[model samples]
Target chain A: MDNQYIEEAYKEGFTVRFAVKKRLFSEQSEFQKVEIVESTHHGKMLFNDGAAMVSERDEAIYHEMIAHVPLLVHPNPQKVLVIGGGDGGTAREVLRHDSVKECVMVEIDSSVVEGSREFIPKTSCVFTNPRLRLTIGDGVAFMAETKEKFDVILVDSTDPVGPAQPLFGPEFYGNVFRCLNDNGIVVAQGETPFYEPEAQRSLVGIMGKFFAVVRPYNFTNMTYPGGLWSFIFASKGLDPIRDVRVGAEQKLGDFFYYNPDIHRASFSLPTFMRKNLSGLLRDK
Target chain B: MDNQYIEEAYKEGFTVRFAVKKRLFSEQSEFQKVEIVESTHHGKMLFNDGAAMVSERDEAIYHEMIAHVPLLVHPNPQKVLVIGGGDGGTAREVLRHDSVKECVMVEIDSSVVEGSREFIPKTSCVFTNPRLRLTIGDGVAFMAETKEKFDVILVDSTDPVGPAQPLFGPEFYGNVFRCLNDNGIVVAQGETPFYEPEAQRSLVGIMGKFFAVVRPYNFTNMTYPGGLWSFIFASKGLDPIRDVRVGAEQKLGDFFYYNPDIHRASFSLPTFMRKNLSGLLRDK
Candidate 1:
């Protein structure tokens, strides 16, 4: 086939390219202007009115793994708080659990939610759920004002930048600690184990300060640049993995995503990761 | 950006589009052509040139999990046969064990071996080792011709289609059972647990008919369409996970992939998978 024909195939977006480039989504309505002009080791940043909706390539694995792990860990988890899942994939999975009562999604960008609802329908199903309470504002600010503690809190924000940078800081984690019930657990996409070891180290370090128990886990996803990503689980007064109790006896549905076996397997670290996390342990 | 501008981003030659109208490569080359046109529910395939390196996406996890589980199970493993690993990543990991003396790799595509050596350099390093012997031909035919038995035989094929379809069938598995020395083991990549349950069930069913022990395992990789994937390990004599041992006494190296702790963890099934795999197992 000629280059022109190949070019046509590429333009159709039938085959999603795992490449790095600047992405720009112009604002059509009364929202922020979306322009993504930064390059990372992973795929291109996807900006909606100046905030990341999801990275073009690495979004699914991060969104799926982060949402599924905590939901599987907690038995009969009802009330949930999604701090910054503007894309709504996490919220979609959270509502899949029959036991979930209400999911309060605090997205900083109203434009991201709106754009994603139109562009990415697979993720946007969360908004259609009657149980979801969508609030368009600062996630950190919303958490501070709301005393309604949740059984599970998911911090599904982008990398600590612009509005999200505060979400990774010590104060945000402390507030997340305050916003969770006694049996509550929190899982967040930490960073790439290869590219951003320092970011993972710092986030886990701060999480250790606020939560009595913190655990780091790894999952392999190819769309991501380095092929491996990590997530950190922080709980106020419970050991995240220890608290999990799914067995052969438990009745579970057909899940394409998460389970108890994977719950334990996710915590198994490679030697390179073990070396990086040598002295850090959150066993307070 | 104009349509012409957006078209420029698409790269030809390596891209695989799903729609029938958008296939780039149609003519069969000297290498094989494996087309996943219509599975029960997985993605509809355009044609794939067999000349292209066909690798199980999670090469590290699949290679390490298959080799280590059986080798660790046996008291001493001195011989191994790796079927259909042209890239040599599997052989590289098998060489890590000090107990093994001879390892044979049978791959049909010599170009894939040469191309992977030139392109994917890290995996290609295994080809240079003196302990490893490379055979270029059909693995099933080679296995039937040999009177030589192996301590462990690893069937590392691409997805079950084209040249590899027969590898998952009962006839080839019966040969694999005979090729193994008494108390020897075999492991192969089972299809995705989420997307292709029939493929998983069929392969597991075939292995169960031929071997005394058959078990399915899973690992999550993000780069693939769905997050989780499954692999099955079948042994003629011993339980691979039960007999394996790794502890503080063992000296480990810089492995970015598998470890002993993960060996046991990998065997643990999630509730959803457990439900799907129910009543599939037969008495030994």
Candidate 2:
């Protein structure tokens, strides 16, 4: 523990610096560089390939949003699959639903999971859930070959670089389309709309080729670039708004970010995003 | 300016650094230190007392949300008052409506007005508009003495420190309540809920005593502390949603952030915000 700082350059000239009290863990994992540090403001922070992956203070904002939005929308999410969520935060939210009988998580890097278990137990505590079947392998390959059907698939991958690059490709989405049931839904971490619109539009364009419903929703992430981050929701035919279960959101206990009102409001895109993401948004 | 960087520490341990291309203008105004610099990512940025005020790239997100939300709610806003917006961005949006016959802006520091006009024309261009009447004076004093009534009043002051401290007090809001018409609406810059919840709760508590409807809405700001900022909307009787004029948003030429969908969506609070701001929020 010492006076150390970690800076993330969001763009060419904009950077966010965090005062780290100590470096808890640092490793060159098989997939990417995984580092965990205890920071002053955000407690435990995780970085994958130098990109901020999770923080203790604001982890629920991303994890609850990614898990609850899709799980609440699905009629009966009895079975769920999470890809690339080595942190176990997504599975923790997924198993909160009593209707979920089984959950499977596939992570490419074991170091991320091990690091989370030791340092970020707030999210990694889901490892002991009896319903979860943890798999250590590549998610893209798993999606391409699995014959099992899932009611919901949460693609909690990193940014579209390094090992996560294949997860954003057309072939991976095509495989994801085949693994889901008829009323199944898939939600992925779309890039920040303000900073990475071109990549977001491109990813939505690829998703549009296979799914009948594609929509992007946004939330405020404190550590991310632009403070605004988006998630791409692709479904076979379910509309997130019209098909929302009446009392579904109430069953989930309490949350930091995700709420019934936020579920609908997150889809209300700004004018600039609507113009920039035109033709790519299937709901529009 | 060659290899310069300006860092803003939001909290004790978190900071956002911007690479400065050149210093456009820097002056010690009577109230605070005003500086305008050409930044690499945000184009030209204005900083008031080392805090990010406005940037050329994302100025519309803050300006549009403040002005349009109140203006569109009032049925006919012929007279508008802007307090502490020396940058002219709020007045520019206020005068965009043809119904506004006059707009009076009172800013304490004259140097902020002059510096903005010379360096940041995109927001300061409203100085030449014939409908705007610029005055150099203290807004807190003007609100207590002026007998003139306005349909909409925008309190676009800086953070609750230095000269802007009185603007967040109960006496000022009491004066503002008396100086407004029956159905008048007043919207002021509420601090970020995530980082400054105590201030946000206290301000909302003050406004609740003066107005019948007091609600706080949030938006995403790139350079702000938590990337999420809030505004307090207080009205005598008019509701922002129920009393919204039909087809009024279409009258707006074009916007980067404000829209009919966004107007409604911005008021939805996340779970944590709702819990922390329970008794203070009038709508909840």
Tens digit of lDDT per residue, candidate 1, span B123-172? 67888899999998999898878898898898887777777788888888
Off by over 4 Å in 1: A1-15, A18-79, A86-102, A112-132, A144-151, A181-184, A191-198, A218-229, A245-254, B1-29, B32-62, B115-121, B191-198, B220-229, B269-278, B281-284
**Model 2, total clashes:** 0
**How many backbone clashes does every candidate have?**
8, 0
DockQ, each predicted model: 0.19, 0.85
TM-score per prediction, in order, is 0.74, 0.98
TM-score winner: 2
- Over B182-226, each residue of candidate 2 has an lDDT whose tens digit, in order, gives 889999999887888888888999999988899889999888887
Docking class of 2: high
Two-chain complex of model 2, DockQ on C-alpha atoms against the true structure: 0.85
RMSD of each: 8.4, 1.6
